[model samples]
Target: MTLYQKLKASGNPQAVAQITISLLESHSVKETAKILGVTPRWVYKLRERFRLSNGDISACIKKRGPKFRMPNRTPEHIENLVVTLAKETNLGSKRLALFIKNTFNIQLSPFTIRNIRRRYGIHCRKHKTLTGSRRFATDFSAFEPLQLWQIDAKHIADQSALPPEAYASIFKNKLPPFQFTAIDIKTRLRFIAYADSLDFKNGLTFMLLVAAWLRAFGVKHQLFFQTDNGAEFGGSAGSRKRKLIQKLIFDHWNVSLLNIPERNKETNCFVERSHRTDDEEFYALNLKKVTSRTSFLKMAQNWILYFNYRRPHFGKNMNGMTPVEALKFYRCFYHPAIGSMPVVVLDQLSNYTSLLFDISSLPWDNLPRNKKLLNETMAHYRHSIFSTSL
Candidate 1:
């Protein structure tokens, strides 16, 4: 077979371009077209392109389709927005699509978003599967807001996840080293506090503050706070300190502090999962912006507010609702301020001697009548002591 016939069978663009260039040089357009088993019009078009490219062989190759972009193609700006959101949130295609629609009022299919992610080599990290037996098969789907909360402490000074500037700033500015996180399993409402250390006192203080904040916001249900058996949280079974702290929380707020089984992370999965998000969305992005402990708390407060009031959660049973929205959807009665609860420094709160004394001495029998007093007291600390310290 001839060169054209050989290449026509394979349909190689480079080979066709080379053959077209060579044949056009030695033969007329019609003769070249006849030899190449193509139309004279095609030969004429190739010759014009070749001449325009100064006899470049690549210019002679016919593209597989139209030269112009498809009319249905996503806009460049939209693609750029998608990429920006992908890097910022690291969310999956479906979640990303939902966010775009909700935030920007733009509609995009998940498949289109997935294609954009694939094209840009962006990928969401895959989490490891839980292999060991779960301690409880309890379905949390039926749980209501404040009925179940998962609390955990996460070290925020991770060198690997933080940028060098942020890592240096952590020590330079004496920023809090640990973050105490609490998430309501039902609405995914989260609260956070920072601490200089992960000691038992700080942990107990954090739990009490979270409980007080919840109760202040009309969360009157019996709250269950689940946590891993960390030393800060009273340690494993048979530990005296753990029992003491548990009793303190139970006595103060009627909150039940349940310790998850040792070595099984899946039990406290909600709070544990929130840690990864904290690393990705909060610490990694905002740490460098923190010039002082005050600034860090401000940023932390804003971040938690954004998470609860604005950011959409697409997790199981959440259905693309923000925590605040989820509360409303579930018909759970809660104050809107619950979503914007003040972020406090645990060490500061723990060390406030008079405040601690007041909390401990407050009459539990008259709690209903003292609700306004309790709210005023905490608000005073948040505005006066916490503000001054910051």
Candidate 2:
């Protein structure tokens, strides 16, 4: 038995108390044993342990052995194989545990796999360190409104994080769940579309939807569309056809292309971080409500509406303002043409402008630094535009 187990299994609370007092008092070993009603050998062992730990009582209680135990009673060779697979896949703990169960018939919980990952350097952080030589980084802060956009897709598994009926629908051949996301880097405006499959065709369709939506909203701005080296976004996919995305960005939308470095997902950290936010705030909470694909689609649409207009974001540019507020602020502060455009554009933005829409009303210098974004969120005060649900 380990030292801690042996010490705890003895069930002698008074013994440890006596040892602590003895160490603090600098009592002799004989005096400590007599005070604690234990043998001299036990006192000597405790003293030795205490001295080894440099007078730390808590460290003295810890057992000297391996910290990690393989999950699901997995064999050593199989555990090694799991680590190897982790090195390749870079999956999260629960996904890695599921992989182990499906591939080797070993049942491991997410917590166990997390411990195993911490024990050995098998996590994706190690993957980042592996390629820590040199690479370019994206500055999500440096872009102006409509200066850059990011688009990406996320996949929801067939039988993961759903109810029983949701589980029963996997009949070996069906369209899986996927979501196409587009984000404006400056204002953090997010648009999302759900699809059954991931392809360049879907990428084109989503970009067209974004362009059409922007056109309908009367927004005219040049931007660069950026994506990683994924096959979906016309990257280094080895001749799988990328002309659709190229035409969608360059010809139709008139946006430049910002290609991310190979194997460096952190370069696209904004959208990637937002995906985790969606997973936690939306997907995990709505698992029970999602009964079918249609319901899932509706959920995604509503989430985008909330994300765009309701949710408050805080940053250097978007301090204490929603995406809509941030967008209005940038346009009002930067673009005189937008202010002088047709009354329709002014009307759509009037809800976000201060009373009278006068430049004199702008308290840019009078207001504190933190309150400078206030004039942008003020409406016409005649009606609340966001009263109706999207």
Candidate 3:
């Protein structure tokens, strides 16, 4: 039979391999058996011996070449490549693999890359499944915006560690600078700022700043300020700094101060969420190292602006409006008579418009000046004013 008929009858490459060995035995029993690593009797039992096909016997033989130790890329090299990609792209392994192949001429399987990255501590989700029953201290989703705010402080590096000197300093004094942040649960707007020191003075200053921000937004509703039991937030110590925040909330707006259990930062998860958002958006972004306090403050201000005005929050309670828009709407509700007038009518109140008051982002130092002016104005309007409180 022709090699075509032989190949067709063989069924597949394995059959071809076995038959080819059997046919070679008739040419030289010892040599064929040695090459095929089989007994001559076994080769003869196949019933086709010394039968060389006229055409393409070489094609039926397996192709020969040096196979790669790693067909695509080494696991070590792929791991290094994935880490580099994650730091640069902040993307998952599948997209990162495609990017590496397209951008760097390196090929890697997504599954392998994912395992490598996860082994190296790259993960998007913050929480993992619990093996035991998990207990929640509070129902976080129970309230709307302006009802509650979660506050916390996270430590960050003063500057990026570069190399030998940086590595040395990191080992010697590894603690990062402090960033105090607050998140309005209802609106999900993050108010973040940094300070040189996280002492009592700075803590009080932070509360004052927050109070000023709330005043600027003209939020009149009572609020609940939740915080972890940090010394800065006046844990069981009942420090003056803690009292200041409480006093400001109680005296100014009648807001409540609620402290999370000691060491249980998750109870105030909204603040942690804000911190994570800052880490992903600002810390992970390619920015110059914060060399000076001034530079850090500037970057922080920019981040807060983005948080308040630009970020598209996942929470749908805000009617698709950003935090700034929600603040504006909240102000309208706080003063319905003035807000009831159409913008065109209120446009005439341009100079004296109640809406002119900023409800957020106000500087703390300016609040006292505002209060003094407000008192004087209220005295002037006392005879004509109809309301009990201004």
Top candidate when judged by lDDT against the true structure: 1
TM-scores for every candidate against the unseen true structure: 0.72, 0.48, 0.48
Candidate 2, position 135, lDDT: 36
Between which residue pairs do clashes occur in model 3? 145-186, 216-358, 216-359, 217-358, 217-359, 217-360, 218-359
Best candidate, TM-score: 1
lDDT of 3 by residue, 1-390 (tens): 645246547657556455555556466755655555567664453334224443443434444565555565456766786787787667666656766776889877778778777768886532222335343454546865556878777765534322333323422443235677777776676666555456544454455456556665576666777777666666643555456546544566566778776766667766775665665566545233555444555666666776676554545456446676675665534432211111111112222322433313333232565898899888878855756554
**Candidate 2 has which clashing residue pairs, if any?**
none
Error of 2 at 58 (Å): 24
* Model 3 segments more than 4 A misplaced: 1-142, 158-176, 237-249, 287-291, 315-390
Ordered by TM-score, highest first, the candidates read 1, 2, 3
Which ranges in model 2 have alpha carbons more than 4 Å from their true place? 1-142, 158-175, 236-249, 332-390
Looking at model 1, report the run of 10 residues with the lowest lDDT sum: 358-367
**Across residues 67-118, which tens digit of lDDT does each residue of candidate 1 receive?**
8988998999999999999987778888889989988999999999999898
lDDT tens digits, residues 1-390, model 2? 543345456887444744444654777777666655667787677667778878676655555676986355657786687678777766677557766776788877777677667778665632011334453365756776756878788775434443444334432224246767777777777877655556644565565556555655556666677777676666653332444345434556666666766777777767776776675556645655666655655666677777776666765457556677787787634432321111111122323433323323433233467564565556533235665432
Under the 3 Å rule for N, CA and C atoms, how many clashes does model 1 have?
A: 1
